[model samples]
Target: MTPLLEIALLNIRPGQTEEFEAAFAQAQPLISGMKGYVRHELRRCLEDDHRYALLVWWETLEDHTVGFRGSAQYQEWRALLHHFYDPFPTVEHFVGVLP
Candidate 1:
């Protein structure tokens, strides 16, 4: 069973939306190529500043923990994106309870 992961990011600068989107677009291929990865949904709060969210579905936590973290793609992801973030991103994992 795939687990749903919800990630919220507090963007850094005000006018960085385009840059952030571009970075994520570049990183999408790396993220999607991981083992056990199912899908990803990205969102932005129009009323908020620099607040973005990602809802991801994975086959297991190990996919993210072992597959993603241990892969070179993560390093590339970080290299392409980690700096544009403001205070950094807060990521959380959740298990399915209902539905």
Candidate 2:
């Protein structure tokens, strides 16, 4: 099966970019240590410093929805990073449709 890609469009509260990034760095290990984690990347938007795009690869959709989200680590992840957002981010999953 093709790997799954999880995407999140994160918009941090104004003036909190640096603090959010620091929190995210601390939260990274929580997600990366999960069972189906393959890899991930976080990028800041060029035009909007408060915005970010996060891409996380998993072995399967369940690996993220079930394995990761259902784990206690997720709580820690949330506590560490969730408050930085002005509004909650939306998360979606995708799979490769072509080579």
Candidate 3:
């Protein structure tokens, strides 16, 4: 099966970018340590400093939707980073269609 890509478009609260980054730094290990996690990256938007994109590769859809989200660690992850959003991000999953 093809690997799943999870993408989250994040819009941070004004003046909270630095704090959000720091919180995310602390939260990163929580997801990285989960089952079936392949890799992930968090990137800041060039046009908008308060915007970010989080991309994560998982071995399968369940690896994220079930494995990570169902784990107790998810709560910690939420606590660390959830408050930074002005509006919550929209998360979606994708599959690669080409090389």
lDDT of each: 0.81, 0.94, 0.93
Per-residue error for 10 in candidate 3, Å, reads 0.3
RMSD to true structure for each model, in Å:
1.5, 0.7, 0.8
Per-residue alpha-carbon lDDT of model 3 for 7-62, expressed as tens digits?
99999999999999999999999999999899999999999999999999999899
Can you give the TM-score per candidate against the true fold?
0.88, 0.97, 0.96
Q: Report the C-alpha lDDT of model 1 over 1-99, residue by residue, as the tens digit.
A: 647675656565778888988988999999998898888988888878587777778888888878887999999988987887777878878987888
Give the distance in Å from residue 5's predicted Cα in candidate 2 to where it truly belongs: 0.4
Kindly list the per-residue Cα lDDT of model 2 for residues 3-28, writing each as its tens digit: 78999999999999999999999999
lDDT (C-alpha) at residue 77 in model 3: 96
Alpha-carbon deviation at 24 in model 3, angstroms = 0.6
Is 1 or 2 the stronger prediction by TM-score?
A: 2
Winner by TM-score between candidate 3 and candidate 1: 3
